[model samples]
Target: MEVDEEENNDSISEEEEDSDREPNPKHCFITNLPDQLLLLILSFLPILDAINTSFLSTRWRYLWTLTTNLDFDQRLIVSPTEDFSKSRRLFASFVDRALLLHEGSEINRLRIWFNYDHELYESHLSSWIRFAILRNVKELDLQLEREWEDNDFYFWDMPFLFNPSVFIRDSVRVLKLCLPGLDPTPDMRFGSITTLHLKQIGLTERTIPDLLNFCPHLENLVLDHVGLYMAPLKIYSVKLKTLSIVNSIQMNGSVEIDAPNLLSFTCIRYLADDYLIKDVSSLVEAVIIFSLSNAFFQNWRKIVNALTHVRSLKVQSWWWMQHLQQTGEYSEEILPHKFRYLELETVLSKMELPGIARILRISPNLETMVLESDMVDQMVYMADNNASEESYTGDYLEKVFTGSPLYLKKLKITSFLATDNEIELVKYLLKYGVALEKIILVPYKTGLVSVSPEHLAERFQELQAFPRSSKDAEILLL
Candidate 1:
């Protein structure tokens, strides 16, 4: 009877154990997905992650092979346990294997970005380029950053070249090549590309003009750090809407542009040179930050007059000539007088005040104004004259106030030393500007003028109480 009871108890225990175990579901949601959808899902992932999905299940084994877009960026790899050398080797091996096993006949886009290595990865990189070109990639973005611990250019003598002629497919729309190697055939052309971005490209005289002659559909062009062996480079494009030249050195000749449909023009990190834009009446914005040269002095007025149609403008001059010659004294209607926003940065000496006054006087429609500069001459002028701040500004401020229509809605001054001259100028603007909305004073910490915070508070009170044309104008002492 005890043996019978033990068998019955064991049977009950087995039944409870069987009930506790849950049955596994037959279908996984991801594996059940359509092949096209799965392939698309794999395309969004990095190649490494895409390949790793093969380990998930049989359905995802070869899903990555159908991926038409390949973007290999080494910077994406991050692992705390693994060192970079190991990660780099694994990254290279995976990309190499994936491309070798890729099933797509044509690539939609192929982008590769990595620091250039000459000894080890040169052939690998070249093979990858050839693979993409052979597969008829429509968009190719190849950016090779030259890793340099010292100052010399690492790629100045490397022989592994990137010839744009390899891109023969008419389906190509956008092509960006960094450190683009040179030597082009006379008749070679990119018939379908609409956007071309070239960086660190050593361009000869015939290269740009010849290239632009064939690329008529190209509307946007950016030349950054381009080593232009030819001076006075002529960039003539009818369809170009946006053109920017930055950190590019041109030795002798002045740049001449004739883009009729251009809507924006920007030149920065370059010294002032003659940039003649004739037919850009549609331009709405312009940014000019140029180093000053003697040639710039002669062409300053012409350059300003050319960009007259732009409504927004920003200008900074590192060097200013004490005496300037006017090639042609243009009337207010002819100059760029339609500026709604203007920012000027300079060394605010007494002499540079006229330049500020000149822009203020001409821009009758200007609504916002920003001024930033170190005040040198204004302080010296007051010290040398031994006159009060009000007396010193009585001449310069009154001239600008009377000569120019006072419609400014906002004003900002940087390096606000709270000196008598500076205060007098602010007072003059507050008193004259009838439609002024706001005035900002950024008290620069030059330590040259020592005004206590209490004194600043008193000045703020005085400015708030000291009446002017615009009663609603607020002052911010920041």
Candidate 2:
């Protein structure tokens, strides 16, 4: 009878069979692959996609639960049109069930990004964090967005403090919390975390030091868009290596930093009336970019003095020259330490010529010089109608020109427009750069337009005709 059935099946044409028939597992190469390989392939997919593999077959149903990474987002699971209550219930249920079903003993990373009322899900979030801690999660990232009650904004403190188990974990090495209230208790200790990143949070003087004390082993700290309340914010840590304060709003006072082991300090648009830095002797590099001119005069000298040990400095202070002229702070006594490499982010106009020359005179050992044009600064400089349009006249050039040989070997001009001031700056450098060997000119580009080829050719020829202090000097226009 089996032979008769087999013979009948063989006799039927290929098109006569059901087209929607499920293929045999043995014939499906993907399904037949080793479970380890299949799980590895699933690891690259999003959490939802990885979980959807359970519907494929019984083998894959339990495999996804063993994955090391469980990244859950409420936005990815809940439909916007659904009822708020229903959506919240579904998301909560999904996270709870997923964590319960996870069979892995150790999770590499656990990320939960939820946008809901903290009061409603506080217990649930605490449970999830505890689960992560129990599983020895290495990288724990929690980004919770608090929902306002009546169109009013309020900071929701980290709710896991109720259960000290989550805060006392030693498995988490990298911790990232965004838009959460982070007020660590005096007894809490995050001793294992090496990198701590807090974004869009509010911090006070006490909380800042408390965080540093709690995370004793923290090496890299980043405060992005954080609002500081207390004046004269002081940050002191012995083990901190890299500190980045990006766009942090500080109140009326200054910032005092004392990190003896610090290696790199990056400040971008961080405004403070003054900076009092001490014992940063190990700092190798410092990048300070100020988009506002309010605090440059009061803060620049202190920052520069602290960065005397740095081999490289990248600064964007468009108003330094004007401030120096008004305050008479452009002498070697102000910036006594020299840097090996200097990168200035400013428009090569007469407004910045004196500052540039002063910096050059101080950094007599500078081997590389970069002149970069920051579009925002350029726009601000141009919009000020009261700003004097001082020409690059003989008197102006003569005042800045130090009759000394320059140690600059390589010069780079970015966003070059061949303006009269820009050309004069290039000529001034060429005239004094006795050790100059190479100069690279990058034309300014706007949308689809760039410096015309004919214009570039004319400028290149003109530059070649100018006098050179270095006989082996070469120019490149790109």
Candidate 3:
């Protein structure tokens, strides 16, 4: 009995000893991951986040140094209380340090954003450009936000300008600059840049021609809120494929876009249209945004005339119908054209359906139609005030849908206030939409109580019981 008891005691001691032994290290195989796989994983992380991973373990400390893409954003480093000058200096030092730590390594991309004082801006700009050129950088994006004083004070001595023509190296293939104001000096050149984006820059006729001359091999160009000083500005680019211009003010100067190889074009609030629409056979898509002004309407017509071969057309405007009515060009004159997709927004019920119908008539091949607005209450109120005018419910829907082309397969109504008339409109579409594939109803704040899919299904079934011919329609409520 004593021997058996001793044996049991020995077994328990051995079990406890085994339990006390440590398991294999959790990340024993992490170090074995291939360097290429690790680098690829780190590439997706933002530069700061990737740097922070260095402290996770000793192996990760030097791993970040191997990353070829370095992105430094000063907004991340600046605090409200930090002196702007000191903050700029510290940021510059950090960037220099990071570069030194990764010396002799090739950098794929470099992005820096800073708001600097006038004294530091030029030197820091030179350093960044020099570093990018030395590393044979493929992409360089520098955004300099000028610090503004109180509402009355000016921001800087000179509107912080960096002439890409003079500062950029031939090795850079992609370059983006967003400055408050820039006057490209005559000596500036960007001969080797393939892609370029200029934002909020003052580009006159002479300056634009000079800039274009520098980028002989440029392919893609984006100009946003850029001022054109030259009237009748003629742009001639042979290698350019894509052109995007947004919120640009025209100098009553005619602007021409003459890129033969240009495949895609987008213009928003650009006044002059001389260059784009003139015999652009290769254009596949054209998007135009107009303001509710007489000048824009005249330009809109010219733009429409220019887009003879456009496969996709999107027009967005506030109070478009009122503008058209004010111009006295009714829907019967405009609704015979064809487009693949159509999106229109207006103050609902205030605009005439015939005018909407006129716009729709032009898009015979339109497969999808999206009607968005926040004016249901205004429509209801207007109908109440003018009882003689038809309500914007069943009558309006019947008129528009009945006249609309059957090619429209999808209809999306967003930010809609569902009223009795509006529900009847949806039912009418479901009943008459013979080629319709889907109908989506999105509720806004007002209108009928909560909506659901079951309610939509029941409504659809009730409409079908009366035997309208739209056999394959699907109704969705959200």
Candidate 4:
């Protein structure tokens, strides 16, 4: 009887243990996915992260090498406190190993970004370029930031020179380079390239014109922080549709553009340089941003007159308002062109009201208006002029828009602080904008101030109290 009881107790314990154990899960469905789909998933990840997926299982060990899009950024490998020389060596070694192990015959895109020292890594850089060209890369981006910024450039001594014949394969369609200098060879012709972005490169007067001849199919060109050899840089591309020049240096003389097929033009420069958009009859959009200077006001007028055909215009020039106040020359000349959209980035103060009024009068067909306040310059003019808190005199717009039709249907104000002056301006617009349908108010986003719930509620109530001239008008706070 005792032996029977011991056996039954042991059997009960075994049953309990069995019931507590969970069943094995089914095989992972993702592991069974097709190789092409897996490669596509890996392509979206950073190159380092993609490589890390190799450690997951034996099936993924070499799969990363088959990815067609590879971006090797040195910032991924080196920590901020790492030794510079050691980090460079580590980065270079990894790139070489990765490229050697890559199995793709044709790369869809390849980007390499690093702080380049010509004396130490010129050979490595040259080999990388050759490797991309040999692999039939469709889009290649090389952003080799030079270590030395003060050194003078010599054309023949340009770093990372490759065989001019290697690039004639007509495979690369988009090429972006941010090198100290570019090697211009007579035989260099990119027949398949459609878009080219060159940044921080030194170009001479003859370099660009000569380079354009090489890229027969190029349609988009961007020059950023590019220092020119002399003044009067002439760009005459027949097939080019978009052109942008930002933060360019040494272009003191006029930049004459004659791209007949151009559709969009953007110029953001600090210097008070002049530009002539000749033969660009197809231009429909223009963005011009310049710093305040005595010579910029005249250039602003010329650029606006030249862009008469543009239906959309966005300009940021605080000097225009300041200059107008000092001179008090309110010309009543209406532009021959009519703009459908106008965006102004300036300080919305008492002194700038007339300037804003002038723009509204000129744009008779304007349907949309966007006012973006430059917060940095917002207080400069106000304090300098010793302006009062109530800047809007209620009749400023009416006086300026007299006889000029107010066709504005939509309005947007960004960097709104909901101050007394700003509230007055909103009130004035609401009272006068008879055809207004909606108004958007976007609070300033400097990341320094946070609005309390109470403050937000108060602001909402205040906006609701303002009477609107248009019964259909809606006020939205964003």
Candidate 5:
């Protein structure tokens, strides 16, 4: 009996030992991943978020140190109640610490946005830039906004801590500078930079040449709200494909572009003596906007003549009718002849129809056209008053509708009031435009006034069904 009891006790002890063993974890907990995979994951995160991930675990504590792209945004750090001075100090310290932590890494890009407290942060900015150069950063974007209180004064004259020449190097491929009305005299040896953007900068004749000379390999150039103090600077870029200049008022100088590979060009509020874009056979699209002035007529002619080969064109001449009326020669001489698509936004009048006709004459193959009238109420009222005078009404409508090139298949008219005269205009389109396939009329619906979609669709059908030669035409309403 004693031997049997001992055997049972031994069996129970073995079972208990087996039950105490724990199951092995299916996946191993790896504290470190391949550096390439870490970078791939970090690339998907915003710079700030990536930096904050350092606190997640000890493994991630210095993961940001391996990141080559650093972006510091003061707007994200500054609170409305925070002291600006303290915020600037903290920003400087954080940048310093991040750079020190990532000392050995190859920094590829650094983007910073901060309020331009020149007196306080100028030296710190210089240090940060030096650090970026030491680490061989390829892309650098610095956007500086001055406080509202400094608006009335000249903030551009603030003493710069670093010479602009020091920042120009072969390692940098993209550089963007947003300064407070300062003309930067960058070194010409920074030919490695492929993209350049300058905002609210003053580019004098000498300064413009200096910049072009420096960025010889630049592929994309953007100048926004920049002033040209001298005659338009001559620009010659063999590698440049995209160029955009916006809200630039100083026009005494003309921009002479000789980029052979240029693909796209956009210019707004650029008043220059001779606007020239030559040998850009690769040009595919262009947008030229001019403020209504007599000087613009010359520039417009120059631009239209250069961009005649463009397939798509957008011409926005705000208040141009008033200027044309005042000048007495209400005709646009330089109109594109080969544009497949055209979008015009301006007030239309009888005097301007000839210009429109001229455009259609040149672009005989135009497939689509959009006409947007600025003053719908006035146009409708005028059409109503002259409804009885068929000659007056017919002539006006003929000038507006037939002026379009004969091949226009799609016509979109927006902001039209359904007054009798406007309706007559629509009728003239239905009667005259032989190749018109689709006509979309969108009535001006604002405030408490509204047009029923059903009513509009019905009226459109009635207009299309009005006794016509062909049954292929369709009218749409919105």
Candidate 6:
């Protein structure tokens, strides 16, 4: 006499149920799905909406709680009427409750991103970190942005002191912390950390030792806008394969790298007194970008000499090229004479011809050259207000123009404006490169903005008509 509960729940009277319900025939297709597949479908939905699935039927009542990933993004919770403070508290409460009831015993990944909050949400944030630690979370990402007010003053809603001891479980292999004011303890360690990223943090005397001891297996490291408080910063890691150091402020500390296995290194706008690079024989690629006027030639030379084994190099030294002229620091003898691929970012000007020619001369076996003018910087060039024309010295035409290049074959010129100076540079390379095989000219406005058909045609026509020494050479225009 008792109706089956499962059948009773599935059966709704046609008169009582809304017409919006799924077609009657298709009802059980979803409810009959396996639990594992159902959990995955819930994982893609927001936590709030995922939890609402329990209302569908008895089968999905606790399925959402079994999700191994937790992503709490504030943008999903904010309402038009709520202020920043109210929104912060509401998000905090929702997250705390979700974690407390979350059925997963071993969380695989946890991510939290929220709008800047003030003093009210610190404890909640701390609890979240503790929860991740207790659950042995594998991947954790915490992004805390600063909240700026009318006065342009901002406050970072983050715990300045993060004791690495809490994360000593060594379960976290990949971690990214982007807090502007994070300060670490000297004895902190991330035992199993392999890939680590720290942004807008302070590096003091204890910074290097604290990290090296804690993260022994660290291989990939990226430090961006790190404030250096010490004089000499020494980084020695034998297992490190990749490193990136970028600066938002002038670096007060000189860095010395002793990573023997390092394969790639990138430095941008970093000012150090002197760098001591040793045993980095595994290095194959390097990118160095500097505003030459603000850099010391001697300091720049020391950095270049260390890259003796690099096969691929890209340098952005627009202002530095002019610095060589103004400071009389020109040198054709410093760098090694071995390079397979060399890409340079500079404008084609008479003043830069000597430095460029000197560079080409050193690479006796250079095969490919890429010249990009989109990276042109006129900072130092525009500052030379008292400059009088020197009648365009540095006869690239008579010297590099007439000489026979042994290995130079392929050339690609991007952001080409078809200027007289640029054309002259092409002519110089064409006449000298007896082995030249191909030429590609991409107009300055190629992909950046719209270019008139006439202008684009002119850029291609000018370069194609330029004479080449190799009779079998082919030219392509883009």
Candidate closest to the true structure, highest TM-score:
4
Q: How big is the RMSD of model 3? A: 11.4
Instruction: Return the TM-score for each candidate structure.
Output: 0.67, 0.76, 0.77, 0.85, 0.71, 0.76
lDDT of 1 by residue, 45-111 (tens): 7666675565455555566777888887766633425554554554455456658878888888888
Task: Give me the runs in candidate 1 sitting further than 4 Å from their true place.
Answer: 1-111, 118-120, 130-139, 147-160, 183-188, 230-232, 271-278, 317-335, 347-351, 372-394, 401-405, 412-428, 439-468, 475-478
Error of 3 at 303 (Å): 1.4
Instruction: Write down the lDDT of every candidate, Cα atoms only.
Output: 0.66, 0.75, 0.63, 0.72, 0.66, 0.68
Tens digits of per-residue lDDT, candidate 4, 1-478, equal 1112233233223233433333333424654689999999888876777876654555566788899999988877555455667667666766776787788888989899887776688778777878898899999898876555465533223655434455665899999888775666787789899998988777776877877899998899998878774456889999999998898765556678899999998888734366676887899888887755545677766766688788887886365465555555455342324778888887676666666767665666888989987756556646765756454345754576455336578989887777665675567667767788988988777775565657656776787888877888788888
lDDT (Cα) of model 1 = 0.66
What order do you get sorting by TM-score, best first? 4, 3, 2, 6, 5, 1
Of candidate 3, the 10-residue stretch with the lowest lDDT total is: 1-10
State the displacement of the C-alpha of residue 263, model 5, in Å, after optimal TM-score superposition: 2.9
Please say which candidate is ahead in lDDT: 1 or 6.
6
Candidate no. 2 TM-score: 0.76
Using alpha carbons, what is the TM-score of model 6? 0.76
| TM-score of decoy 5 | 0.71
Clash pairs of candidate 1? 232-253, 271-291
Clashes (N, CA, C under 3 Å) per candidate:
2, 0, 15, 0, 5, 1
lDDT of 1 at 156: 28
Error of 3 at 191 (Å): 3.4
For residues 235-275, write the lDDT of model 6, one tens digit per residue: 89998998888763334667788999999888876767777
* Candidate 2: pairs in clash: none
**lDDT measured at residue 239 in model 6 versus the true structure, 0 to 100:** 88
Q: Which tens-of-lDDT digit does each residue in 215-304 have in candidate 5?
A: 778889998877665556677877889999898745456678888898888887776677777788888888887765545676676777
Q: Please give the lDDT score at residue 415 for candidate 4.
A: 76
> Candidate 4 — worst ten consecutive residues by lDDT sum?
1-10
Model 2 over residues 1-478: C-alpha lDDT tens digits? 0112233233222333332346466648887888788877877766777876655555555678888888887777666666666666667777777787788899888888877655677788889988988999999888876554673333423343344446678888998887456565666689899999887677766877888888989999998877776556788999999999998778777888999999989998887777889889889888887764544756776786667778888886465665565775576655534678778888776767777876776777788989887866665755664555574436756877867787788889988887777777778778988988999999988764467778878888899899999998888988
Model 6 CA RMSD to the hidden true structure, in angstroms: 7.5
